[model samples]
Target: MSVIDILVPAGDVRRMHLLVAERLAGKGHDVALVGTDAPGIARTLDNILHFERAALRIRLDSLLDAVPQPLLSLARSGAALRVDLTGSGRPVASPALAPRFAGSPSLAEAARLLMLGRLPDIAVVLDGGRPVAEASPMADSRLSVARGLDDILARVLTLLVIETHRYLDGGAMDARPAETAAPPKTPTSGQMVGTYMLSTVPRQIGGAARRLAFKLHRWNVQYRFHKGRRVADTGLMAGEPWLTLPDDGDRFYADPFPFEWNGRYFIFVEEFRHGGGKGVLSVAEVFRDGAPTVPRVILEEPYHLSYPQVFAHGGQIWMLPEGGAGGNLVLYRAESFPDRWVRHSVLVPGRQLFDSTLLEHDGRLWLFATERDGYGSASDMLVVYHAPALEGPWTPHQANPVRIDRAAARPGGRFVRVGDRLVLPVQDGTLEYGGALGLADLIELNETKVRLTEPVPILSPIRSTYPKIHTLNSSEHLETVDCIAPMLRGGLRRAG
Candidate 1:
């Protein structure tokens, strides 16, 4: 175990700092908390946070939570390595610094982004003052400024904890250079005060009132299908004459996964009823005349289910729908095709895994999903697990969360293979959950390493009636997608 020191601003230590120290210590490291004098701007930032919380009535976990006396006693024990959270770019006295940002602190910049009505990019960390690790953190876009700040900070803290573990394990870190362009100028005290007074405060109040007015209106997801377009033929284009899979006034459908079995085609989805309050797996058969039968419930559980990833293997059909709420990765086998399914095996147990997807490559089955470790958005961290077969033992990748990006981390639909290239359907949740869809090229995948090209924009809700379009999949003759829009209570639809 290595003796590591976490450096934070003196007289400004927050709960996040203590949380980091506790996590490092839990990993069997000798950890110390070191306090350094902070810049004067830190006080201004704190005051701004306080003002926003009171003005917006945002109830956030106090950042000033007191640290345990035992942990606080580990201060200044002379550790050789340090992790800097101070946002001060000063040279540290330690022999090594694993991860620190090069520019203004992430929190300050994030608050500025919120003021500008924009999403903040995930913070990048550096080793020896060189860029080493970076991933997109996820936050709810529909929150007040104070609440949004808290959400982003929580996700950033999770990312830091993961990176710290990787650093100590001698794992391979991304060696990419930091972006050369300087970040936007930090807002001055006068600018902050003026903007909050003239813009942010009023906008937030109006937004809150509007939300309350629409509280009874529910956001519903619906699936769309198009014929004569195979998965390979549909490139980065929109405006196809897609047919909407009609839903009853009571329920909605989403996460469409299209599959071709034998000579029949089917589309599986998550059918969620307003009163049920949870989703169940459902499937609809598509006829050759471009019509779909009513989707019927195929599977239900005590907990929620969605994203029915159906495929054929070992001469039998199997479905792996997301069971994140159940805290396990389960496989279901079709006793009767497109209908009866029974539990096959528990591939993974006791974990909150979302949108788990399987890919067969290099003679192994690779599973990809975003993990929720009791905090932060489940849409940011892309983790990998692989096994030789469908059941039994599965091992997590060395770089567990191979990617951390809100724009493309969550799996939207089935993987499409076009000749030599593999395209991954990804959910762009930077602005809103399922706000758009993008396709990422899988560059490499193996037992030890995984790489993916940045996602290219494909479909979005811009200039469209739908507010969000997330899932995308296709069979030989039909392509499928799902989108979200608001519907009035009691099953009345609204035209956007």
Candidate 2:
């Protein structure tokens, strides 16, 4: 077994670095946590947390007091070493002193040796963006202690684990050596700490406002055609009469997934009722004469469901809808066309997976979804899993959460093939969760790695009352889109 060495800021009251060290120890590594700020970081686990969270902490703090000596030895043992400088004091600006974080040169050399397997080490630097939640000009303005601190830790640790696995798998390391340039100088010790505080006040206020505004907004479906053309080739849908499904007073429909079966066109959507606060999967047929049949409630679950991803596979039709709230990837096989469906199997259980999508290529089945790791938005990470068949054991992609951009990580609609490329609709949640939609081409996909090209915004149709659209899907002869528009609270208000 390899013993790993980790560096953390001294006197970290938040205990985030300690939590990360504990997690690493849980993965079967003897971890030595060295403190950079003060000597208290070298304290034993018993002196830190109570007995309940002590197992992993005990393992990480085993050699906590050995100082920087073990870090060099662990470097020679092919053990993973990580340097975490988050929540540390910034260097006072001086002409003679290097502005870079102290001991970063050692981190760079360790990373180079780690890549060569001479000594496996991974250094993580938290990019503290402009601090959030500043009530006063004199308030602490550092990136530490933000409202999403736990979420940030989750993301960084998750990335660390993924990158570690990548290196272990003989894949190229994503953690490159640090630059030789001097780091930027920060405020001195006397300066008020520039870190932000993590408070729920803003979110609480926002939530209450949203509850009030929910009375006015409802989602509706839209449709158009691209004829297999790329976004650059398929210009904007200007002056076109976008189609929409009629809205009911109690429910709203969204996550439109359209597919052509045999000779007919069908769309499956999420019908969310205001009273029950649960979504039921519904399907509607579109006629050639520009008319939509009354959508029939096809599948109903005790828990919420949305984004019914439907496709034909192995002489049978299958559906994998968003059952994230149920904490499972629920798959349903169409027993009787679009109406009668039965629960086939649960692909992944106990994971709060959102917008699960399947793609069959090169004799392998790929599953895509956005996972909520911590307290941040659910659209932050794009996780992937693959299997030899639709059923059976599914293996997580080595590079799980392949992307972490809030703007384009969430799956929005179906994945459509255009020539050699596969275009998938994705949600841009930086504005708001599922606030807008765009299209990204799946550039490279394999068992080990998955990559998506930059997304091009699409389907924001001009001259439409529904200003916000977030989901889009297409078939050979049929297309589907969804948008949010305001409706009266208790009754349908006709547009004046």
TM-score of each: 0.85, 0.70
* Candidate that would win on lDDT: 1
lDDT by candidate, in order shown: 0.73, 0.58
Local distance difference test, candidate 1? 0.73
Model 1 agreement with the true structure over 363-479: per-residue lDDT tens digits: 999998998765667788899999998984999998777877889799888788877899888888876777777888899999889998888777443565664667788766667
Which 10-residue window in model 1 sums to the lowest lDDT? 94-103
Q: Over the stretch 261-372, how does candidate 2's per-residue lDDT look in tens digits? A: 8788888999987777788999988877658877779998889988898999899999999988888887899999989999999889888888988888888998889886
Clashing pairs in 2: 100-183, 140-194, 141-194, 141-195, 142-194, 142-195, 222-481
